[model samples]
Target: MSRLIYMGFKLLEPYEGKLSRTVLRGESGSNPADLPDKAIASPLMANYILYLYKTMRKFWGEPIVVTQELGDILGNAVIKDSILASSDTICLLDQSKFRGNYEQVAKLLALNEVEQRKIFTINGLDNKAGRGKFKEVYIKRGNIGEVYGVEVSLFQYLTFTTEKPEKTAVESYVARFGSYSAGLEAFVSDLRSSRLGLADFIMQVNAE
Candidate 1:
């Protein structure tokens, strides 16, 4: 059986009424006409997510599974829409999804041993050293599957720099690693190289 890889991002900061009304305007089952023209606007995070979706698709192909923590403030409708736009297969991580006393939802979601080994999670570290450390330890424990900590700031910087130069920092740093990717070219190169692990993993699974 071919191993299935799942990739997703976790927002470090919770979304608390930050999404602009503009993006929420055309949402299904929502009436935007009732509100004023300037009443709603999209948040910067939303734009970042859109860019991320495009990058993931362009580089890694469409994700077989997109997951978000249950009851997480960051798991809003706009984010869900962005995830769904890339792939229809969505897995909302919640307590109920787990069987028995298992706390690791990823393990429960895995259909088989190959699937368990193939799972990869990209956590939005947001420059938090402690969170990155925790993920490192968690991965070392080998109970929750494979986890990758992605610096949220680096992603934000790359997104803004790609769109408009001179706005974001020149040196983008990966959270907790003290590694920096200088300039757009270096950033793109590093990002692609880092994601190559996923590609390689998938390739190995197919070869098997």
Candidate 2:
């Protein structure tokens, strides 16, 4: 058997390029002093999830978990305890799709009648006019829970969307400027100048 070991600085480099030292070295100013607070968050880093969750809490940092399906947590032993138990705040989007099997979810999250009502009320409110399309979310911290409407601008929508075509178009522009933030700024400027809606702009890009 042969071995390829990357020790020392080689371990700090990203797969293709140099890792950003700002977040890794606490140079971002928002991070803790002289501590690698970011630690390059990745799905593959679940090996140390429990440790990360415990230590981060001790340092006044939060560890968040996001999943499309509740089964991802309820079905797993490690996550069912480590992540779910340690999470103090819970955020939920529209969960009407899980109405049939929601009792388990309710029990798991320890939701009371008020909290359960709040969860079902997500995206069920009468929003004001000219506010653009948006969805509501339920956020529960401690014992109380509240539903808040989430409405973002066009640029923010593109930035946050998970659709393949939209992401592809966004990345195409990102590649041009060699910086995601700068590229996204340029994309928004050009999109506005084109005077087309987001759907129309996406269709035009996909066609070309």
Candidate 3:
């Protein structure tokens, strides 16, 4: 076979297990790393289909046939669209990343303490770290860059003053709100302010 053909085969061979086929050969016999260097796809041009195939096979199983003629369903399958749209539900908790004119966000938020607290959640979402204890207030923008069909253009500014301000508080605040609309609003507001010491404020907002 031609070198290109060899390379293509090597790239695809590892993912063939994803297809629902009864294999005379061992179903799990696939190794892209075993191919010669010349048979490997370039990192930039690597096929996503092949990658998904391998990933699915590894995650799902060697055989995906739902032989359900006489079987009991175990659990519910998670729909793909639900996962995709779920990210939009996240809100901003920070008021940092908005520098210069963005200081106005803080001022605006402070103007209405009730709205400020409303934007700042007293409890955070449930995740690996457990439920969030404090709230955040921020503005939203678009995604900053793209990854996995998602664009990350949002920016934010954050503040969570307590009895004793700790670094972790700020980190948690930024992590929660740094990607949504409220965060972006805070960011743009600060950028437009152009006040003296604004650089310091920006640094403080995103310090962690």
RMSD of candidate 1 to true structure, Å = 18.4
lDDT of 1 at 42: 30
Please give, for residues 9-122, the per-residue lDDT of candidate 1 as tens digits: 122112212222322332222111121121112344445455544644454333232233332223345544555444434333222333353334343333344433333222
For model 1, name the residue pairs that clash: 20-41, 21-40, 21-41, 22-40, 22-41
Better structure of 1 and 3 per lDDT: 3
* TM-score of every candidate: 0.22, 0.56, 0.18
Candidate 3 local distance difference test against the native? 0.36
User: Residue 174 in candidate 1 has what lDDT?
Assistant: 36
Off by over 4 Å in 2: 1-47, 158-208
34-85, model 3: which lDDT tens digit per residue? 3344322333223433344345455533322111211111111121122212
List model 2 lDDT by residue over 36-86, tens digit each: 222222323333455545655665554565666565667766667677877
> Alpha carbon lDDT of residue 41, candidate 3?
32
* Model 1 lDDT, residue 128, Cα: 53
lDDT of each: 0.35, 0.66, 0.36
Clash number for candidate 3: 46
- Among the numbered candidates, top TM-score falls to 2
